[model samples]
Target: MKAIREARGIGLRRLAEAIGIDPGYLSRIENGQQGAGNGTLHRYAEELNVPIKAITHEETPRDQE
Candidate 1:
């Protein structure tokens, strides 16, 4: 996520404004402090021109092995 954002040269504030979310919220997301819903995930995928799967992925439990 940070890679995509930085690749586009967009700041957190700009992305938050474009997505109609709070910059603080975006900051939390970027820092792995919070999770985003499907809608928010799609919005970011659209804005970044990246696949939604790239931004939102399922976390495999350690016990799966």
Candidate 2:
């Protein structure tokens, strides 16, 4: 997520503001310390001008073995 966001030149704060999420929360999400819900994923994709799959595909299952 951070890679994609960086490639698109979207700053953390800017993306967070655009998606109505806290910068810290977004940072944690990007850092893999937190997970975002479907709605948040949609919000990120909308703000990033990418598809939801693009956002979702980047996330791995948290408890994957």
* Reference-based lDDT, each prediction: 0.86, 0.88
User: Tens digit of lDDT per residue, candidate 1, span 1-65?
Assistant: 87889999999899999988999998898789999888888898899998777887654575367
How would you encode candidate 2's per-residue C-alpha lDDT over 13-52 as one tens digit per residue? 9999999999999999999899989898899988888877
Clashing pairs in 1: none
TM-score of 1: 0.82
TM-score of 2: 0.82
Best by lDDT: 2
Count of backbone clashes, every candidate in sequence: 0, 0
